[model samples]
Target chain A: MNAVIFNGPRKIDVEKRPKPTLRDPTDAIVKVTSAGICGSELHMYRGHQKTATGHIMGHEFVGFIEEVGSDVRSFQVGQKVVCTFSPVCMCCWFCEHGYSNRCPEGLAPFGTQGLAGGQAEYVRVPFADGTLKSTPEGVDDELLIMMCDIFPTGHYGAMRAIECFRSSDLVNGNHYTDLDSPKRSGLSKSQSLEEAVFVCLGCGPVGLCAILTARSKGVRTIYVVDSVDDRLDQAAKLGGIPLKLGRDDVQAKVMKATQGRGADAVIEVVGNNAALRSAFDLLRPCGVLSSIGFHQGDLPFTALECYQKNLNINLGRAPVRTVFDEAMEVVAANKEKLASMVTHRLPLSKAAYGYEIFEKQLARKVILVP
Target chain B: MNAVIFNGPRKIDVEKRPKPTLRDPTDAIVKVTSAGICGSELHMYRGHQKTATGHIMGHEFVGFIEEVGSDVRSFQVGQKVVCTFSPVCMCCWFCEHGYSNRCPEGLAPFGTQGLAGGQAEYVRVPFADGTLKSTPEGVDDELLIMMCDIFPTGHYGAMRAIECFRSSDLVNGNHYTDLDSPKRSGLSKSQSLEEAVFVCLGCGPVGLCAILTARSKGVRTIYVVDSVDDRLDQAAKLGGIPLKLGRDDVQAKVMKATQGRGADAVIEVVGNNAALRSAFDLLRPCGVLSSIGFHQGDLPFTALECYQKNLNINLGRAPVRTVFDEAMEVVAANKEKLASMVTHRLPLSKAAYGYEIFEKQLARKVILVP
Candidate 1:
């Protein structure tokens, strides 16, 4: 099996690896159908998070169930599925309560010497009953890849961002705006985001898919912020307001567009304290700072600013299990045109090239076809 | 009437002042029966927080309703009542939402020479409908003083603290408690203590009240910590396990008592960030850290700590409206036994002496009888 392996800083290679097996009674071995190279892959590649060298580098994918343990049920061999970055035990309270990302039986490649990640020919998924969501019949491979991780992550951002704006008010004092006000034009039972504007930072596939999910929610004006001109062009092609990063006064532009208020919500998919602060500033008071970025350090937001503006702050890794199905429904419904998010598709033997493209910031959702 | 006016830091003196008149249709003139000294009063005495110089200093009191506003209907002339520190409009959203303490119209005093506080002989309570609660039939003046403020704040600490502990087993993390595991004995609803050990720092009424309320709540071990030995003794007389501050590892002692599990809750009645941090660290993973103290500036505890340990951290100015009835009920039920929490009673003319004694930490609860 061909796998993408992280060697050292900025280094990735296509390496021959053994296919995985069901290591537990509840495990399933999935033949990788499509996996996406992630920015975090590059981070690991460069040893930024110092994940060990030669760690099979990707953790985002959709695949086919090649084998299942004796205890597996409802899911049969050869069934198509999307697996989250981390496996969880659905029976655990954390999983039942929508915190599957923090599942007690979390199984991920935690170190450099960790097992081969999803960007390989096959991967063993532990806690198969809880971690694997079967792709609906006839869902395409490209779209199913999203249900595996990034798309659900983006959708989770959207859902939690809306939740954030609803609970915080007056406390975010100077930051509240009526566009996001639940007391005002909030989504009714019959209404969804039909004409909302979303500002996404880092125009990766996750960002682009956030745009897609935003449109499905009825959002009309989507703003994409990134330093790369190519990503900005991709944003414009996808019907987004492409605001060049570092040059755009995003808050000024957003407020001006919303008549000096602010966007309904800003999905800060980029982590770290700076992006966290930017999301707060870009939001109208009561706006939500929906962060999906994995920063393990202190966020530097002037908390008083959020408190005074009554901005809502949300954290954690993606709540993937809960939104995986909904994301699939939206993607399957929009089938014919969703492939644009996968900019580079390569054979499993070209896994190194996929990593290189993402590392060079030249691709959005590079798909690895095994 | 003779009032001991707080002129400035170290500047209280006996002065002749006119009795308050009904300045607004919603205002009431109270013939103050007894005004209690407060921990916040020290903020004025030490010149940390400002107030109008020569203005009445107390913000805690029980008094007779000498007069009512034209719109006031809940009380009749000559009814004994306890007045909250700030004036609140009952119909406002804040009052309606039950956070009357942060009422929109209420005055927040700073340096001396600001609005009237409660220390004077004739204090005018504006917005009588929201600010004053009439004593039930014959509740004595000393007992009513608590319903004025601190006791509810302490109870808020006790209740909010017990709620934040996410799970008792996480601090050890995978070594003992696995996620979703059954809760253990110490935090069980049936847990017992000979005297619930509550290490309360600051021995002021808020701390002392926490000791007493914990006792009332069936907390078997009550540990009170404060710099003043006298205040520690005050907690001891009220059935507390007093630990003199600067003389003990309060957290070590608390953990020692709970068999290495921390105290159920650590109420930081003193508002310093250091105390808040100490309270947070002293807790068993599931222990609650309740801040009744009005904190200023950035709090130091890492948000990650709370999330990882499933710790609950709640900070707010005291929410007095919700707990008023509960506190008053306790006071009324134990009026005779409650008198011990009070230490000094003085005439309005000696309000200066009351402030003096409180500033030097000589009085626990000083009441100015007008």
Candidate 2:
């Protein structure tokens, strides 16, 4: 099988590698239909993260189950499926408590940690019964691939920001009883997202997806910030108000647009100190800062700043499984709008080129079809 | 009039000062009946915080309305009242949103910023209708003064931790409707504190008050961590399992007690990096780190650490107003247990001596009576 592998810093290559096999009864062998080049993968490509030479790369994939372990009762051969980045055992303490992202027996999705990359002929998936969801009939490969990572992740970020704001509202009112209803999911009916302003930092695929999710959720005022002109242009084309990272004074622009107040919620998809600081500065008092970026070091803002602003800082990996079903509904409803985000597509053998263009910020999303 | 002034670093003195009068239509002259020396005041006393030489000091006070401004229609002269540390207008955006702690028109209670200290013959309170709460009939000065700061602040800390935990639970479950019930206050009836293990990081007056509040609210396993033997003794006396800071391996102790699961919630009252780190270490995955300590610099933990642990870090000033009424009820019900926390009392003229003893950690709480 031809697979993408990490060669060295700033290096990636597609080379012949041994095909994956079912190693455990709970595992399933998947024939890759499509895979995504995630922004987090760029961290390893640039040596910002540790990765061994010849390490297979890619975590997001849509595929067909070629073989299923005996223990995997929910899945069978030849079924189209999409799997989350983290393979979780549904019965683990963390998973049962709704924190599948931190599942004790969790395995990193297809590419890293000695797992064969999904940008290949085939890949092996563990905890197949819990991690892999059958692709809904007739959904396009582009949309299904998104369910594997970016879409649910972006939705999780937006939902967290909105929920934080709602929690504050609960604190201010006597409507504590409202929290019991499932209807209070992300954006409630009474609380229109159209009335709140959302700021997305880093117009990468995740950020763009966040903008799309916010729009589909009825957020009217969406500001997308990024250094890349092409990404900003794409954001503008998708009903977002684009702000150039260095050229536009984002804080000043957001404050001006909000009539001297800051944004109601900020989805920080770029996990760096400057972006975190900007997100903090762009929020109104008691606003929520939902951080989805894969951050390495300490949070940039001081405890004093967070306290003085009365900020609610929620930090964690997105439990994609929690929002996967709902995100699929949104994607299925707005397939055309979301399909526009996949700007580049290539054969699995050309994954090296995909990494090159994506790393340089030359494409919104690069889909590798195997 | 006589008042306690911040003469300089490590210096406090009772000096003759002009008696305050109505400064605005919403102002009221409060004849301070009692004021408590707070742990935070020790920060200014030890020169950790900048304080002007003539700045009046004291933020927790209970008093009688000596004179009411014309616009202050809620209270008449001789009405007993208690004021929170921040004099909020209640009409500001923050106040209306239930974040009176960050009120834009907020003034430091009693002292700093030209507001006269409550440890004086008379203090002028602005935003009288909003900031001053009428003292409930039969509530003693000791219990009422507790409401002025430590008690509510401690409750605020515990509530933030519990609320953060509750909010995380909502994220994991389908109980969005549960948030609407007032019964979903801080500690839900279904999610009793009795089942959760709580760790209070400091044994100051506020931390001790937090233990009492937690106990009154049905928390069965409460662990109080502090360095001072006397403070730890007091905590033990109040039905807490006291752990001396340096003598005990705090994290190991907590983990051993919880069967290696760590604490369910940690109320951090000591606002420093080491204490913050300890609080973080004592929490199990997906736990809440509620900070009530007045932290100065950046959070010690990295964003990656918080993310990996799935931590919900709630930082901010205590919205004392939001919980003042509720706290009053708790205080009235547990007056005897709480009054035991006040170890020393002195006349207003002896405030200088009170500050000396309190600053030296020789007393748990010092009440200065006018």
Candidate 3:
């Protein structure tokens, strides 16, 4: 089978790899149908992440089950399915609690955990019963593939941003009167998202998707910030108030827009320290900064600043599988707007070119068809 | 009037100062009946915090209103009251939303903002309507003074720790059916504090008070860590399993006690980076690290580590006013145990000796009566 392999810093190539086979009874073999190159993948391709030569390099894939181990009950051979980037067992403490992203065995992406990548013709998926989701009827391949990672991830970021307001409401005694009623939800029902002002940093695919999710949730004013003109243009096209990163002082602009008040919530999709700092600066007192970016090293903001602002900094990997079903509904309903995210598509043999185009920021999203 | 003034590093003196006059329409002149020396005051005493040579020191005081400005409504002259360490204007956005600690004009801890401190014959308090709480009957001076800062601060830490669990439940779907019912409290009614395992780092007055607050909340197993024998003894007397810091590997002991699972929640009351790191290390995955300690610099844990463990790092100054009434109830109920925290009492003229003894760790708490 042909696959994309990491060959060293700033180098990748198409190479022949042996086909994958199910090694566990709960495992199943998936025939690669479609996969999306992610921003995180760019980290390894640019040598920001340490990767050994010939590492199979894809985590977002939607495919058909070609073979199933005997114990795999929920899935069978020849069924169309979409797999989460992180495969979960569904029984671990984290999985049971909807934090499958932190699952012990589930942390492994398709290519990085001694498992082959879906960029190949065949890949063995462990914990098949829990990890694979059947493609819902009426959802196209692009949307299904997105459900594998970025779409749900973006949705998770937006949800957490909204949750910040809900938490504020909880503490302020604005809502939640009954402590005994099992029917009571923690967040305020009367607080409409239509009143929230959201700021999205980075304007990459994930950032753009976050703007889309915030819009769907009825967020009123959405500000998207990015350095790339193309990305910012794309964000504007999708109804975001696009702001060029270097040209505009984002903090001043946001403060002006909010009438000297900061944003109600900030979606920090850029993982760097500067972006984190901007997100912190953009939030009002008691506002939430939902960080979906894959950050490395220490936190950008000091403990003193966090305390003074009374900020709720919710940082982590998105529990993609937990919100997969809900995200699919949103994606299915807005298929055209979301599908527009896929500006470039190519055969798996041209995976190297796709990586180059993505690395240079020449395309919005590049999907590889196997 | 006499007040304890910050002369220089490791130097303090009781000096004569002009009697405070009501400066604002909402200001009140408080004749401080009793004031407790706080751990944070030590920061200014040791020159860790930059302070003016003659700046007044104390922030925790229970007093009688000697005089009230024309606009003061709720507070009356001769009414017994307690003031929060951070005076807040309750009408501000942060205070209105239960984040009084972040109020713009509220960060003024009686002494720091050109406002006189309560460790004097009389202190002028700003935003009297919002900052001063009328004493409820049956509460002692010691308990009321504690409510000024440490008691509510401790309660705030415990509340944040429990909130971590509630947030986990919210995402896991173990509880809360409605995401918007508004009738739901932030925490789970069914979950008993009797089942929670709490670990408190630092055995200072605040740490000891936190242990008391956790106990009042019905927490069954509490581990208190400190190096001082007297402090540890006090913790043991307060129903905590006291662990001396240098004699034991605190992490190992806690892990063993929790059956290889780390503490469900950790209260970091010591404000250093090492203590913060230990608190992070001692928590189970998804556990809450509620830091009430005034930390100076950056966080010790990396963002990647926080993400991997799914940690809720709730760091902030306690919103003392918001929880003042609730803490008063707790302190009043546990007066005996709470008052025992005050091991020494001195006249305001002996403020220098009080600071010396408390700085040397000779007393658990020192109360200066003016």
True contacts kept of each: 0.01, 0.61, 0.42
Worst 10 residues of 1 chain A by lDDT: A182-191
- CAPRI-style class, candidate 1: incorrect
Q: What is the TM-score of chain A alone in each candidate?
A: 0.86, 0.92, 0.95
lDDT of 2 by residue, A1-370 (tens): 8888888877778888888888999999999889998888888888887867887888889888999998999987988899888788887656766666777666455678656667777888888998899888878887788888888888778777766666665433222333434232221123336778889898887887788777766688989999999888878877899999779999899999877768888999987878888899999876778888988887888877876787778777777875677777878887777767888899988888898899887777899987
- For each candidate, the DockQ is 0.08, 0.45, 0.40
Per-residue lDDT of B65-108 in model 1, one digit per residue for the tens?
88888989788889888887666776754455344544567645
Candidate ranking (lDDT, best to worst): 3, 2, 1
Q: What is the DockQ of candidate 1?
A: 0.08
Provide the RMSD of all predictions against the true structure, rounded to 1 decimal.
8.6, 3.7, 3.0
lDDT score, residue B346, model 2?
Answer: 97
lDDT of 3 by residue, A1-370 (tens): 8888888866778898888877999999999889888888887788776757777888888889999999999987889999998788877656765666666777668767366777777788999988899998988777787888898888878767766555554543232334454232322233456766789998898888788878876787889999999889888877899889779988898998876769888999988888888898999876778888888767887877766676667778877776776677778888888767888889999998999999999988888988
CA lDDT scores, all candidates in order: 0.65, 0.79, 0.80
Output the lDDT of residue B269, model 1. 84
Q: Model 1 chain B: which ten-residue window has the lowest total lDDT?
A: B170-179
Cα distance off (Å), candidate 2, residue B207: 1.6
Considering just the first chain, candidate 1 attains a TM-score of 0.86
Best of the candidates, DockQ: 2
TM-score of each: 0.68, 0.92, 0.93
Error of 3 at B193 (Å): 5.1
